[model samples]
Target: MSDNQNLLAEQRRALILDEVRRRGGVRVNELTRKLNVSDMTVRRDLDALARQGVIEKVHGGAVPVVEASTHEPGFEAKSALELTAKEDIARAAAALVQPGSAIALSGGTTTFALAHHLVDVPELTVVTNSTRVADVFHTARQTAGAGGQRSGSPVVVLTGGVRTPSDSLVGPVADQAIRSLHFDVLFLGVHGISVEAGLSTPNIAEAETNRRFMRSARRVVVVADHTKWGTVGLSSFATLDAIDTLVTDSGLSEETRAEIAEHVPGLLVADRATSGSVPGNG
Candidate 1:
């Protein structure tokens, strides 16, 4: 196809996605007939939308991407999706923690996944804003339940502050508490990251609260899924250069990966290939 044709195809894909989201599931034959395009063209459009997480491919059609109805899922609900990717990213993030290190776990499903993997990492000090992350480790500490690295359990510290609907501690109190604590590493799991927008969240107060952790911590390691790329959110906490390392899945686009490597100096891109994560670790 010509460059112009490819560009037009891209435009068509966007329109198709908009239509699918507006009208719910869209059948392949119907879209092909309505748009006066071949079935292959319709299939290609669906494929591209799925890659961007804007839509889901079905047996013969495409459906609007079904996100967690509540972005803030309870423990059981959050555990259901992205379990493997989150675990793999968690292991890589945890390996950065030494036996006697002070670390911070931000609020998110991915960070909560990281909390479970950190169970056996002993002698480390964990300071987190997420009630769930703290509760997970504290419950293990009290119950003596095992399932982590089989080393030693980390010391748990939960900040006292106003809880958001997402069960995350944020606002002035949380920011102050985080600033007072000097951490060896702060693990942030956020909504989106762009070369321009940096690390962002959907809430303004939470974003501001996270900035305090970024300022106080010695190193900032961001853990996110591949889908976070190109996505936009409400508030940006840190620029790309501000983060020390980025640990994400290998599914990120080549263009986005190249952009990050160029814009963010000394940013360690850790995945199964470059990092110690087992292949298919997630």
Candidate 2:
């Protein structure tokens, strides 16, 4: 069974809450479809949620514990939040990319923002898995030309492979290409982070490849917003110990922070938005 189906009780409850918040009511079909779990497994999940008063069980679905329109936010609905957090994290992360550095920007809104920030920095090369990020770098080069600037834009390499539903390029081809390069740093976007489950995501193929990326890189810095905390997804490819630093929003709970600190041992936690004083910051 997937971790999403058998997560620790807290992680499972957090997912249920996020689901109800995203989709309002949860029907057996909807839960099974979105989570990629079996119908029986979803029912068991719904039953557990209902027993905790976390949801109201209907004949064929479950409603929110609270009365509200729990509609899933569309991509546009999430854009503003994505932009703000990404900007903060990107700024803090960008300072680490020194001249002559070669780095990989994983496919994610956060890394996409980092690409935009790199426009002014000179003498760096970037490998990426996001088409949108590649376009940004290309545009930045044109902007440089129009301004009569001689500084070259960072080399942008886009991974070629099958695109996932979430718009990430993954699998053997992309992974092999990534393996060919040595990077000073790898900035990654993540779906879920748990103390025991490590770093989990919904796609198995991407998870497998990200595991390899973590192994290949000299440093792996995970960038995520507060929403990922306490959640568990379908696949786990790396452990907390594998991460060098975690940049997230300031909204995380102290308990969650403490658990992660205990698990990752020497992990550094930075609230990208505030206290820009990251661990080891001068």
Candidate 3:
């Protein structure tokens, strides 16, 4: 094909993929009309993307690849899925924090919830990669000052790096920033956890950054809801034995709990009560 024709083809394919991502799926006829291309051309573009494994070609059209468990959802979407369970787990994890301690928290909705619970803890130095998590501590400091509370605010250190779809900063910048510091404990939020795969995340960059957090901390505490038990993501951050503790809600199955117990010696189940307090097995 001529250079001009090749450029046009590439642009058309880009548009088709973008449409498929935005709408979840797109018909060949729709792409033809939208891109002012022939039906055969649309089909050719779909076929090309399918060959690259970027999209799945269905009977009528194309859809994004089926990677539900490996797909990283945005903060709002994840926060809405397991509200109570995450909150309970966060409460349980927060109870492990001691005053005048330095802690590291990786990015995830569950760990973001844990940040809220740590607001009142005095004399804590928190290092995190989530912009939302940093904002939570920043707001708490502002609120405490407004109320004229004498207790010192928690120190928050936000690492800089490339932002992912989940609003986590990860990459070389974040890894370098964390290497110079040390934390007493590290609270990691993962997309999935299993006996075989251990703690995993959908984003490779986030996985690399999480490993740095583990290296900088003495104790590694994984905070995740029960839904994350069977799911496995694109990258595994830590093995079961490397984790010091696993904090999760009681919704985890008995069989799964038993299996996890064999790997994680310290597993805490957060049980929610009618009084709105979270109790942990500890």
Find the candidate with the highest TM-score and give its number: 3
Q: Give the clashing residue pairs of candidate 3, or none.
A: none
Q: Which of 1 and 2 is the better model by lDDT?
A: 1
How good is model 1 by TM-score? 0.70
* Cα-lDDT of candidate 2: 0.68
lDDT of 2 by residue, 43-142 (tens): 8777776665557888888876542222222223334443444566677777778877888888767777777878777777888777777888888777
Clashing pairs in 1: 84-282, 121-152, 122-152, 122-153
C-alpha lDDT of residue 53 in model 1: 62
lDDT of 3 by residue, 1-282 (tens): 975686566556756765776578999888888888799989998998787666899998998875655688788877776566788788889989999999998898999999999988889989999999999988877776576534666888999999988789999999999989999999999888877898888888888989899988999999987667666898998899998888987666566677777788688887664323332323
TM-score of every model versus the real structure:
0.70, 0.68, 0.73
Candidate 1 per-residue lDDT, tens place, 178-228, comes to: 877898888998777887788777778888889998888898888886656
Candidate 3 TM-score over all chains jointly: 0.73
Clashes of each: 4, 1, 0
Point out where model 2 deviates above 4 Å: 1-82, 146-150, 265-275, 278-282
Instruction: Give the lowest summed-lDDT range of ten residues in model 1.
Output: 273-282
Residue 182's C-alpha lDDT in candidate 3?
96
Instruction: Write out the backbone clash pairs for model 2.
Output: 24-70
